[model samples]
Target: TQLLEQSPQFLSIQEGENLTVYCNSSSVFSSLQWYRQEPGEGPVLLVTVVTGGEVKKLKRLTFQFGDARKDSSLHITAAQTGDTGLYLCADLTTSGTYKYIFGTGTRLKVLA
Candidate 1:
């Protein structure tokens, strides 16, 4: 079975603080994506880094794909209340059935 593990299942921080979340797996993936979901809404794609050691930045959020394609990380600089949400990492797999394996989501709360 393919699985992704994420750290810091929950986080709370004051506005303008920095935080980092990690996703790891024992299996290699062809691609990995990061998403942020707001209350009652589906996750919106934050970024997708397909190349190993690749990094992409969206405003204050930065995403990185591990060189081995088995892990990823998300870093937020100067986080704001608007950054509060559930962050998830997913990887597509073809183990019996083609599907995506999601990490144990991380809930972030940024206080104003």
Candidate 2:
């Protein structure tokens, strides 16, 4: 089984501040993804990184995949209250069943 580790399990910041979260694993994956979620709802996909060293941006958010494909990071610039939620990283495991494993998760609270 592949194990994923995420840093800074939680964050609380004022609007207009910035933060970064990370996900890492010992096993390499073919692709990696980031998601944002609100209470009582399923997570929404933010970005999928297929290539090592690839970076994708959406508004004030940026995502990056490690060169070894075993890690990823998400950076949020000038966060807004609307950005408060749960952030997650997911990757497919080598299990023949193709199981998807999610990271420990980062809970962000952006204060107004």
Candidate 3:
């Protein structure tokens, strides 16, 4: 069974702080996506990395895909209260069971 596991299920930080979250899996993925969701709203795609050793950035956020294609990471620089939300990582599985398997999730609280 393919599964995506995320580290630091919860995080609390003050404004301007830096934080990093990790997503890991034993199985390789064709593509991986990161999303951020706010209360009562659907998740918004933050980044999608397909190739090994690929990296992408969005403003203060950075995303990296592992060379093995089985892991990924997200780093946030100068976090603000506006960054408070749930971060989710998803990997496409080949089993045809589900299109993607989402991480348990990370709840972030950025204090202003």
Candidate 4:
């Protein structure tokens, strides 16, 4: 079974602080993707990093895929209270069902 575990599962940070969240798996990922979900909403696709050692930045958020393809990371710079949400990492299933395997998720609370 393939599972992605995110470290520091819960984080509380003040505004303007930077933080990094990690996602790791025992098996190689097919498509390493990152997502964020606000309360009462579905997860939003943030980025899909396919190449090893690839880094993508969206505003103050940075997403990186591991060189070994077994891990990923999300870095948020200058976090704001609006950035508070549930952060998740996911990958597509190899079974051809197009199903997504998601991590347990990291709940981030950014205080103003």
lDDT of 2 by residue, 7-108 (tens): 889999999999999999979966798889999999999988899999999999999898999989999999999999999999977688877889999999
lDDT of 4 by residue, 32-109 (tens): 899999999999999998999999999999998899999999999999999999999998878757888999999999
Query: Tens digit of lDDT per residue, candidate 1, span 23-95?
Result: 9987987679898999999999888889999999999998988899888899999999999999999887877
Which pairs, if any, clash in model 3? none
List runs of model 2 lying over 4 Å from the truth: none
Best-performing candidate as measured by lDDT: 4
- How close is every model to the real structure, measured as TM-score? 0.95, 0.96, 0.95, 0.96
Worst 10 residues of 3 by lDDT: 92-101
Q: Go through the candidates in order and give the clash count of each.
A: 0, 0, 0, 0
lDDT of 3 by residue, 1-112 (tens): 8878998999999999999999998789778999999999999989889999999999999999999999899999999999999999988777866577788899999998
Residue-level error in angstroms, candidate 4, position 80: 0.7
lDDT values, one for every candidate:
0.91, 0.91, 0.91, 0.93
TM-score of 4: 0.96
Clashing pairs in 2: none
lDDT of 2 at 31: 73
lDDT of 3 at 3: 78
